[model samples]
Target: MNTPSNRPAKGKNRAKLDPVYDLETRERALALVSHGRSLNSVSKQTGISRAAIRQWQVRIEPISRTSKCSRPDDLATYSYLLGLYLGDGCLSRHPRGGYVLRIACADAWPGLITACRDAILRVRPANSVYLVPKQGCVMVTGHSRHWPCLFPQHGPGKKHERHIALEPWQQQIVDAHPWELIRGLIHSDGCRITNWTTRMVNGERKRYEYPRYFFTNASDDIVRLYTDTLDSLGVEWRTARQSRRAQNVSVARRASVALMDAHVGPKY
Candidate 1:
């Protein structure tokens, strides 16, 4: 019987081998590349071969091109995302490259979390979306280089501390899909609640229930934008003070609440 030895095979008998990398490793490498780092630099930092990185780039280029070739066709989805962003969304610079957009959704509303994730995908399908759990809320986050381009309202300070205004194109989208925007805003920071009081009716004390919608925000500019849109839709609203610093845009009129019910309703 012939015995095997620790000798290298020659010619056709030699086996070909290639290193395998995990998806997370590949993503990290690509993220560095996306940040405009040189291939040599990334290769040295990531311990990945330049040739392999090049192959990855070529393989993914077509997909990126197809996904980001034009603006999203779903303008309504974009409008809704805009409302969510203005309400509870924030943009932070990514350590690798580009920016990350995060929208806080209450854990109680799983449907809203799903909706927020779906909306982010619709807007930036090429980017990756993540759900991060917090003390009482879930953060819906996505990574993209085009976030600033899409959300021009991003600035140096808090949204309420600075001016918040929409671009003309954004206004056009909001105009076309005003209900979707309102629904998003309501989902983020507004709520529909029932108030009750006892009154004498037919010589008997009866409790009457009143359903109203309240949109509370610290930003005067955001409040103005919301009320302006409501006005355009003929939805009556008034500014009421809930506290010394808290102002709520209240919609208590039967007709207005009916309109809100027909469109926004209550958050899930």
Candidate 2:
């Protein structure tokens, strides 16, 4: 006698279960929902399906939620963090499991390190943020499984060697919070400086000072993104060759410098 195969019969399909989420992720999503976050918002932030979230809402009782981690309601924070990430951050796979987001902050600016840590917590409150010291900088790092969901730009190879483009959702956020993004970019890779020149005025040599902002990056795509955002904000900028490959975006116009001063002052 021939034995029957265990596989599904031809022309008939077997039902498949949805991918299971770990208890931590499940609780985090449910907590967001309990706190009046819409299924859609939580879904986008956590990369969890709305249908699954709804089911959990029905089956589980609401629990007191901690700041452990949830998607940030303030898109400004996310935009700023995005700028920092695009400027000097990297996402790598964790040895234990999940992904780690790390942004290098100069040791000279202790405040920026704190800000970086806070941004990570705000974006994913559940994840733990830590500081790793390097030769001249500190790495503000956070570990979470949902990092890729928030930052789809993560991939293999160096950022400058590859193409970098924002997703539609990220574009929307950047549009709404352009200054925050600029502030972040400046904080990471841009600087405010003063240039001085001697001019003849009233038969005497007078020193004239010009304050400007310069954003330097190696990736053409990133440079374009910075200039495009500046254009939209009415901030005039010009590109100059910082090196054979690196380009420097200069905001030298008086009005543009003033605007940058008001919104994105020198990093502390």
Candidate 3:
């Protein structure tokens, strides 16, 4: 009888062979390639072919090199970056690998944006900085895996909504470069301005003006850190009237204003 043999027909096996990969696998594989891994290496790790990895990279915008983890040695600059991150910075996972650090600075203060860019570059020399404009603010972004290591407070919610605390090592850095840290915090969410009010004295109406520094944030933890840092510097700060959106820490006392001016000047 013409029964089937143990082996299939010559072309039958080839016809039955289907694609071994799915969309998610292809994306992940391509992402690995984008993170500076060679096609051969990714193929070995994922069982994907080198040709397919190359095709995926060509199809999409290529991911840059994998970010190296390098702790910043510049104490001043590192502390400043930390404070900035605590105020208005965020870290997001890169599709391919590593992470992206973004800090929002107002358009009115272009120099702050430059400072953020410079600070990031100081730590991660291999990555490029990007300034993306949104309405009234500019987002300064750079890619690196070291950012989270530097700022462990990075997490899933707004700074005020989360439990933000400084590690002992981070606290030591801030203690050494308190001014830089304050500068970053003020640049992000605080401002120095002239506050004016009308008062009646001796049956006469008078207008009085005072220079004060105001730090507004939703996170009580961050505000506490701010006050604590100020205390360390022997500069007094008090909790001002609270609003629905944010809480205020005011440095309106004459001596305090002068002290802050010495450390954190206006965002010019």
Candidate 4:
């Protein structure tokens, strides 16, 4: 924005022409801001956004190597973003330092990111996490929840019809197996896949999946269901990579085949 002329009425003193704020306030605020104070910090201290302070061209230069990370609101927002970064489904321990979690459900997200950070930090310390801007080449699965927080109170829709299926650790699972998936026993009715509407912040893409299969069964994703329904009747019939044989079955088959190929069968 164009700076309004500091010259008040023609006769006004040049010093008086300055903005009404205390003479030193703007300078100090700008100094701190240029020195790497976060917007939240500058706003709290000077009652002005870092944006406002940066408006003056003189303050545009970087002043410090480390930007301030402490602010009441920032702690929450950063923590949330940080948590989102650590959560599975987006990025993995790729070739580079790490990966970036695409902004999923922005509806509540980014907001939930703030809340999630606390949730994550409660479980893991902040320093343990390293934040980088898109530093990995690992593949990532799309996210599940409506953006923001996943708390039941912040459920996807007001009706609360469906629960978010994306687990926070799915990315790790994907990384663990690379391109395989393991399951207890997929006894589906020969049909697998779900057509649920994905709640993506960006609406340009969609993938309809059913009969979820992964390259690795010993994954954290598998653990999700395993932990949720661990108790089993001793008579239960199942096949796992670990199982040497299935009763009355010929040769043991590997579920390592790609999901699409599984339905298509070995022949064309």
Q: Which pairs of residues collide in model 2?
A: 68-125, 68-126, 69-125, 69-126
lDDT string, candidate 3, 110-134, tens digits: 8888899999888677778998999
Residue-by-residue lDDT tens digits, candidate 4, 1-268? 4345643455557547545644235545655655666767777866765555656435434422223223223233332333233223233222211222332222222333333334334423432322222423222222221223322112333211333343444434433432122121121001123334554557666654433222212234333432232122111223333332211111122342243344222210
On residues 1-268, what C-alpha lDDT tens digit does candidate 1 reach at each position? 4446855566445425556876546656787898789999999987888999998887776534543435657999998998899889999877665679999999998989999999999998878899999999999999886788899899988998899998898899999999988888888888899999999988999999999999988888888889999999999988766565546989999999999999888877
TM accuracy, model 3: 0.74
Q: Give the candidate order by descending TM-score.
A: 1, 2, 3, 4
Better of 1 and 3 by lDDT: 1
Best by lDDT: 1
Off by over 4 Å in 1: 1-43, 46-70, 242-244
Tell me each candidate's TM-score: 0.77, 0.74, 0.74, 0.21
Give Cα-based local distance difference scores for all models: 0.86, 0.85, 0.83, 0.32
Candidate 3 worst ten-residue window by lDDT:
61-70
RMSD of 3: 9.7
Prediction 4 TM-score vs. true: 0.21
Alpha carbon deviation, residue 245, candidate 1 (Å): 4.0
lDDT of 2 by residue, 1-268 (tens): 4447665554435224457776667766876776677889988988888988888767664422421334468799999999999899999975434678999999998888998889888887766899999999999999886788788889999888998999898899999999999999998998888999999989999999999999998888888999999999999988755786688999999999999999999888
